[model samples]
Target: MTAHLSRRTLLGIAGAGAGAYLLSACGSDEPSTPDGPQTINWWHIQNTEPMLPVWAAIAKEYETAHPNVKVVIQPLENEAFKAKLTTATQAGSPPDLFQSWGGGVLKQQVDAGLVKDITADVQPWIGSLLPASVQPFTIDGKIYGVPFDVGMVGFWYNKDLFVKAGVTATPTTWAELLTTVSTIKGKGIVPMALAGKEKWPGHFYWAYLAMRIGGLGALQQAAKDNNFDTPDFIAAGQRLKELVDLQPFQKGFLGAEYGSPDGQAATMGNGGAALELMGQWAPSVQASSSTSKKGLGDKLGYFAFPAVDGGKGTVAEAFGGGNGFVVGKDAPASTTDFLKVLLDAANQRKSAATGAVLPTVKDAADAIKDPNSKVVAASLASATGFQLFLDQAYPPAVGQQVNDSVAELIAGSKTPEQIVKDITKVAKSQ
Candidate 1:
C-alpha cells in the first residue's frame, strides 16, 4: 500500500528525533509478480566486507529470478547514511528499504507517516524471529519493522583478572558487583575501563541501572509521561553514584576515546583493566585496538548487568540494539517481499555464520559459529524484555540529555537529583 507523508512530518522528525525498524528472517516466500517494471531503491550501512558481497549476490539472484524488478542498492557508511537518510526524509523521500535501529526514531517515522505498517505483510513469517528482538519495532501493537540481528550490552570482563583478585564468581547483585570492584581495586588493578569522554558508553550504566531498579515498564512509562523525575529514576542515579564513588575506572578515563590507542577497548584488550561494559562487538574491537592486535584470547568472559537488591527488573531484561531495515511508506509492494528474501531463514543462517550478526530468527541460532556470538544469540533467544539504547530510545534531545546528565553524574559534576531533573526537563520539552 502506498503512503504519503506531508512536509510537516519532516519538521516533526527533526524537531523531535529519529527512528528505525527491523525485520524477521525465516519463511521461504517468493516475490509476487508485479503489475509492471518497478525499481526498488535500497540503502543499508553494511558498506564493508563479507556482508557487502553477500547483499550484492542476493540482490543479483533476486533480479535474475524476477526480471521485472530492478534493485538499485546504495551501500553507505554509517554516518554518511544517517546524513543522507536525514536529507531524504526531509525531502519526504526515503529509500524503499534502509537501515534502522528501531526506537524513538522509528516511532517518529511512523507518527509522521513515513514508514509502512507492515504487520500484515510480515505476520505470516514474523513468528520465526525471537519475540524480544521484535519488541523495539512493535509500536501501538503494530509491527513497522522486523529485526534480523539483535544483541545486548553487558559486562565483558577479563577472567584472569577476576581470578587474580581471588574472585570466584561473577557478581549477581549490585552489592556483589560493588564488592567485586573494590576487591579488584584492592589488588591495585583497575576495576573497569570506560570511555568517559564519549557519553554514549557511560549512558549504558545509567540505563541498565534504571532497568534493574525501575523495570523496563518504568522506562516506557517515563517516555510516555514525559517525566523522568521519578523515585525509581532518582534511585537509579543514586545506585550509579554508589559505583562511581568507588572511582573504579582507569587513570585517564575521563578523557579517553572508545577506540583510540589508549581508549577503553584497547585498555581492556591489553589487560590494563578488569572489565568493560560493551555490546557484542567488544571482542573484535578490543583485538583490533590492542597493541598486539589480539585481545585477551581465552581470558575474556561476559555476564549480564548485575541485579539489584530490591529491584523490579531482572538480569533477563536486556539493553542494546542491532541492525534492521524499515520499508519506506511509499515503497513498492515487492519491497516487503524482497525483504522476505533478505531475511529468509537460510539467508539469516548465512549471515549468522559470517560471525558479524546475531540473527533474530530463533531457528537460525545454530548457525552462529562463534562461541561468544552464540552466547549473545542464546541470550536474545530467551530475553524476557529488551530496551533499546536510551540515546536512540528517546527523542534525540532527551536521549542526548540522558547521555550528558549521566556523564556529568559520573564526572562528579551532577547530583542524582539534578540529573533526574535535567533529564525530566528535556523529556517534558520533547
Candidate 2:
C-alpha cells in the first residue's frame, strides 16, 4: 500500500491563505537548496526486509543518474504511515511526493485538493497502460497519480493439510466450501486462518459478503454513502454469520495482533489450519520460515471467495487494488522531472524484478520473472473493475467501528445481525 503523509498538511498545501507561506518560512525546514540536488522525500509503506536490498539498489541507481536530484526513501509501517502523513500535511510539513492507494483514500486526498493533478504528464502514456490498472487513480477526467503495484484478496490453502484431510478438490460453491471446512475441522485441522487482529484483513469478509449479496456496485455505493442500514447490508452481515458458524477460522484469532509474525507462522506452519483468505501480497511462508521449501511455492493455492448461496453476484467478482505514488500539488519543476524519470521504463522494470510488486506499467509487468508475480499481473488484467480495500474505502470512524465489529463477531460477542446493526448505526450517524 502507499505510505500516508498527513492529509492535514496537504489541505494546507492546497490553499491556506497566507498562513501556509508564513509557516513555511518561519517553522518549516524545507528540503535545502532548490538550486542544488532537489531532495524529494519519498515515503512508502512497502516495508519488508526482503525489499530493502532492492530499494537500496534502485535508490543508488536513481541518484547516480540524476546527481541534481536525490530521492530520500522513508519506509513506514502501513497504518502508521497513513496517520503520520495525515497529521504532517495538516501541520504544513507535507512531502513533495508520497504514496497512496487509489479509490476512496485517493478520493479523500484529491477532494481535499492536496494531491497534484498530473494529467498532463500521464496523458501520453495512458494509451500504453492497462485500463484496469489505471482506473483507480483516474478521477474527474484527470490523473492525479501514477499506477504501481495492484493486488487482490483470495484464499491461500495448504495442499498438504488438504490431502491429509482427504479433500480431493478445491471448493467452488458456498455449500461445497462449507462442507470442505467441516471435513477439514473433523480431521483436526483448522479450516481457515482468518486473522482478526489485522482489521483490514477482517474487512474482507464484510466486503466480499456485501459483494455477494448485493453486487459490487451496491456494496461500494453503500460504503461510499455510508448506507449500512440498507437491507442488502444486513443480508451481507447474515452471510458472514453463516460462514462463522462453520468455525472455519483458527480459534482465538480475533484477539491476534496485526502483522504478528509468530501468529502467522503458527497458523500456517505449526497450527493445523488448511487455508487462509488473504491478499496476494502475503509472500510465501517459505520466505519467512527456515524450514524446507517443500509445500511452499506454487503449492499455495488461491481462489476467489465464493458468492452467497443465492446471491446477486458471481464467484468471479472480487475485492482488490493496492497502493502507489502520487505527486503533491505545487511540486517543484525539478521534482516533477525526477518523478518522470522515476517512472521511466528502466526504473519501473527494475522495481518489478524485485518480485515485491505487480507493476501497473506493461513493460515492468513483462519483466517480472516470478510466476506468482505474473499471476497477480494476469489477474489485474482480467478484473472487470478493481474494488478498493473495504476499510480504506469507508470513512475512518466507520472503518474503526467496522473493525471492532469484525473482532467482536469472530469472538462470538456479536452475532452477524448485531454486527449489521452496529455498522448500520455508524452509517446512519455518518
Candidate 3:
C-alpha cells in the first residue's frame, strides 16, 4: 500500500531544530583549494556487488574527466566502517568524504567540527533530489550532506509460503498480523525472519509498533523530553511481546546475522520463513546470500507495517532512513562537485537499475525496475510521516539502549515496563 505525507508533518518529524547547536560548534579549518591537484578520500559501506563496482567506476570516470583530481576509495563493511569512522572522527581527522546516515551521529560530527556545511555548494543541483531524501542531511537550515539513496522499512514476504499457510491477503491491522502469524505457525512454517544477533533488525518491530500506537510525534516528543516512559511506548513493547510469545521466528534466530548464509535474509529468501521486516535493500541481500543466489525472485512481495486498532499514527507514516555522504571539514572545494556527479540523474538511475538502491533523485524514480522496489518507492513518496531509523535518530547511548532493551524483551529477559524504564534511563542520561 502507498502512504502520503503532508509537507508540514514531514518537516516536523524531520527534526529541523534538533541540531541547531551543531552550527555554532562546527567551525571548519582551512578550506582545500580547487586549484592544481587534490585527492579526495572517500569511505563507504557498499563493499559488495553492484554498488562496489558502480561506485568505483564513477570515481574512475571522474578522475578521467579531471586528471588533476584523484579519488581514493576505501570500501568497508557496515559495522567495521562505523567503528573505524568513530575512532577517526574522535581523533578530529575523518575521511575527506565518508558514508553518513544523517541524524544524531551526523550532528555529533558537525558539533565536533569534523564535517563541512555544504548548503551553498550543493544548492545549484540540490533541487533535482527529493526533499525528503535531503531532509535527513539538513541541520537547522543548512545542508551538510547529499543523499544518493532513500527508502523505508516494510514486510518482504514469501508469497508461496503465505499461500501454503492459507493467508489469502497481507495483514493490514495489528490483530490481523498476529492472526496471520499464528496461522503460518499452525502450518508448520516460520512466520518471520529476524536478525536478533544484529539487534537493529529486531528494533524495527518495536519502533514500528511505537509509531503505530503513539504516532510519529510521540517519538520526537519522547526524545525532546528525554523520556520514553509513556503509555504508547509501553504498549508498543506489550504488543511486540504478544508477537514474540508466538515463537514465530526461525530456529536459533537469536544468533542469526543479517546477510550471512544462515542469516535473516537467506532464511527469508530460501523460504525458511514467511516474512521479514526490512528495508528496500532486503531483496538484493537475500539474493546474494541465498544458496541459489537467486532468492525467491517473483515470489517475493512487499507491504507496509500493519496499523494498530486505536493507534494515533496511520499506516501512511513511514520508518526508515537513506545512505548519504558527508564532506569532511578539510575536503577539497571540489568535493561537493564530485558528490554532485555521484548523484547526477544518470548515475542515480544506474544505481536504481541495479536493484540495490532506491534512488534519491526525483527523476530517477522511474528507473526502478524491480516490482518490490517500486512498491517501497511509492510508499515512501506517499508517506504521511517519516522517522529516521531509531538507531540513528537519537543520541548514540539512547538509541543503543532502545536496541539493547528491545533485544532483552524479545529474549524474555525483560518485561515491557522494564524495557521502557531501561530506555528512559539512558535517554535521560543522554
Best by TM-score: 1
Shift in Å, residue 340, candidate 1: 0.6
Whole-model lDDT per candidate = 0.81, 0.63, 0.82
Candidate 3: tens digits of C-alpha lDDT, residues 90-165: 8989999998878788888888899998976776678787666776787776788887888888999999999998
Give the CA lDDT, 0 to 100, for residue 357 in model 1.
Answer: 76
Every model's TM-score: 0.93, 0.81, 0.87
Instruction: Flag the better candidate by TM-score, 2 or 3.
Output: 3
Candidate numbers, best lDDT first, in rank order: 3, 1, 2
After aligning candidate 3 to the native by TM-score, how far in Å is the CA of 136 from where it should be?
2.1
Q: Whose lDDT is greatest here?
A: 3
lDDT by residue for model 1 (352-379), tens: 7776777888888889876776787778
Candidate 2 per-residue lDDT over residues 31-58, each given as its tens digit: 3335575677877665655455566676
Candidate 3 residue pairs in clash (backbone atoms < 3 Å): 3-382, 3-383, 4-382, 4-383, 4-384, 5-383, 5-384
Clashes of 2: 11
In candidate 2, stretches whose alpha carbon ends up further than 4 angstroms from where it belongs are 1-39, 46-80, 258-262, 285-295, 334-337, 428-430
TM-score, model 1 to reference: 0.93
lDDT of candidate model 1 versus the reference: 0.81
